[model samples]
Target: MNGPEEGRIRLTVLGGYLGSGKTTWLRHQLHEGQFARARVIVNEAAETPVDHALLGQASGLCVLAGGCVCCVAKAELISVLRKLCDERTRADAAGQRLDHIVLETSGLADPGPIVAAIKSDPVLVYHIVVSEIIVAADARHAMSQLRSEPLGRRQIEIADRIIVTKVDEAEPAELTKLLSTLVSINPAARISGAVKGVETALPSFEGVAPDALPDLNGQALKPPVAPTRLQLDDSIDWTAFTIWLSALLHARGDDIVRVKGVVRTPAGRLLLQTVRKVVQTPEILPEQDGLGEDNMIVLIGRGFTQSQLARSLRYFAGKR
Candidate 1:
């Protein structure tokens, strides 16, 4: 599974609970040309792999059948990804470089372990970088599923972006409640509605800095923590900000769900995001009209306190 790789491949993992329309959202993306230059891996517990069949004649489509790719078939998943990387490298000479790789997990899968595997794997980490974890939630049944299934809630908790599917069928009140619940569970995730199809632009890693990716193999790690969110109100010092975040992830990488926000730094305004333990390169954004200079960051993770975050951030602010 080795080849003459040209550059890193962006990987997007799509996950959700059973009957949450993960397949439907993927179908839309394929038809809409959103994944035009991407290789897709579909995981299904059943032997037949119905979703693969529905996505007929699409190039670079593969399926991992008989088990969830996150657990029972994790090794197989890695093999498939490596194979794609090799193929991409071979095709590079022909000017057919792979732009991205999208993995659609079974509705029952937990994306956390799948993500951890990618970040932990030495070989895969070199060629692949996770762009985002997009979770599809059924708007009509989301509340019920959230209450009954731990996986359902966990999916929302770790998502970078959440697409609420089947919105056209859900009542206004039901949709409102579902949106409220989702916000409470993961304040850092960007939530969007998908009715007939997703019209909104799906999140991507488009201008991320190259140095944002952490060195997973070299970092000293710790136990996973409980989920918590921290919102900061003041500007941050560029040097102190990097030092604090690097140290935090170095020690508690496993506990972090995601850290995302826009902050005013000495360099400029930048958009920041981290999935699992790996951070995407921060993208510099243009200043918006009528918004005064302000720095705000929302940290969502497991097992940290608001006071603890506030105190640490205050120390950094004082340095600024």
Candidate 2:
């Protein structure tokens, strides 16, 4: 979405539910130079943000956190966009002028409202054009979620393109059911598969029947998800921590939706993450000095408190 000469910055909005791999997909796209010279904005619902650490190579990067951009943080997003437009307008003609922005929204966001906000803003309507709304769907968990999570269904319906992520990890039957369900939810949106954020061909399941999802009410009906942060020291045992995580997920996978953070060890900085009960492979990040959020993990789920998380993790780390 680049109308460079007209000074209107084209915007692409990327959204997905908790742990849907939007960050992974966006990181791969950035590494592949898919959006050259485009500014990247990451919206983190949690106060302690780590997603921004993965996308370091963007032309410009900013993190918006502490609220969901589609709801509580809508005004903040608009203000940032306006600031970008002002900078671009005043930029010297001899300097490089970026004309595109990719906004990676929080997992809990609804794209329809965000889109409406952008279109209705008098100033933004002229300064920015929303080129696409791309949503990433988790192949393993979407079938069950679309049936229960109203936000998930709305995301699918509002998307211009749907990227079914973790295709290789999910069973073929489950992937098929998810794909068919996505079609039933938003046949107007183009759908494709991605394994580890790399685009891949989807297998044909022509006769497969989509899941019969119920009519979910608004987001208020579901239990609220809040982030709980756990601080770990560098000397903490990674092995013990993993064991603790496995136990926690086994007991509360339904409630523990996401776990993500950067940790330090004998090796380089490691990025740890999990979606539900599925633990993603840890990634080694390029060392950055004075990173405050390191040695901390943020768990997003319901029915848990920060003190419980702290006590559990501390005990597991042998800090009796």
Candidate 3:
């Protein structure tokens, strides 16, 4: 977008294992305008999603979010970038410019495929460039999760910058142990701690060796794992889906992890959020004129699918 300064598009790729607070950090970053004027791509693994609703004003900022950007949504990722570039060109024709691009990958996702897609994709090179990978870790649970999850290790492996969140929840001893563990996982990345909400500081990607570890062994880091993606383009019956979803939540709220998305309602475009059974109707933004997409919901869990819950949302498109 902004052509005069560098003719380069700085990209910040955010990644962290599930529940590591990636969304919270992104919400802050986007609001701060740190990555201003950038096209954002948010990826989620589940059919019932979480962060989208909490993203506040930035919900309209996202270009794609269904599954991991590197896996199932790779094509859409490229399409969004191309669209961003085209928009920038139009702006240039009209005497304006844009800034960089930011990508927020699912917590459970491995940054490998997404990185490869951006670096190797021919068209992307014409417009954007990968700036850095920012990995967030929950200080309270990071050590154990790093040891137990392959996705966790992969996130650390690809990090150019590592940030520790939820420091207030961790004791001094636990924080010390976490820093020690992080050194072994990624010594090159600068480590910083965050508490509650306000940890706003200039991002640092310095001291990260380009070839920090050749042949990064994610497999040796943890047990076997599998990745997934789903795409649906069918129309959704909002009335039926909403009624069914509410009933299902009342019955098995404990089974839900996180549910979030922009839903089409008779009133207007409504933002929905569900943390287990507790559902809150978030503030609705002005109608996005001419934007046409399904009443989409992305839910993520240990064993969730379009078949079981998709029917509940069957009035909507069948799990896209």
Count of backbone clashes, every candidate in sequence: 5, 0, 15
User: What would the per-residue lDDT of candidate 3 be over residues 1-320, giving only the tens digit for each residue?
Assistant: 44533675677888887657777787787777766566666776654444555565463466354456778778887788787778777888777665677788876677878878877878777667777889998876677666555567778877888889877767766676667667777878877776543483433334432322234354454222322223333355655566767886787664454455566566676766564455655546455433323355544444455566655455443454
Residue pairs with backbone atoms closer than 3 Å in model 2 (clashes): none
Highest lDDT: give the candidate number: 2
My TM-score estimates for the predictions, one after another, are 0.60, 0.93, 0.66
Instruction: Give per-residue CA lDDT, model 1, range 1-320, as digits (tens).
Output: 13543468989999987657777688787888888778888887544344554454346788887678888889999998888879888988999888798999976589999989988988888888888999998876677657644667889999999999877767766677677777777889998878645754323323322222223445454443222345545544667778778777777764554465566676776766564455657767665523212354545445787688778766766733
**lDDT (C-alpha, whole model) for all candidates:** 0.71, 0.87, 0.64
- As a whole number from 0 to 100, the lDDT of residue 177 in candidate 2 is 81
Candidate 1, pairs of clashing residues: 209-281, 225-302, 226-302, 226-303, 227-302
Tens-digit lDDT track for model 2 on 163-274?
Answer: 9998988898888888888898889999998887899999897999988887665434667887778888778898898889999999999999999988887777898999
Task: Look at candidate 3 and tell me the lDDT of residue 146.
Answer: 66
Candidate numbers, best TM-score first, in rank order: 2, 3, 1
- TM-score, cand. 3 vs. native: 0.66
lDDT order, best first, reads 2, 1, 3
Lowest lDDT sum, 10 consecutive residues, model 3, at 222-231
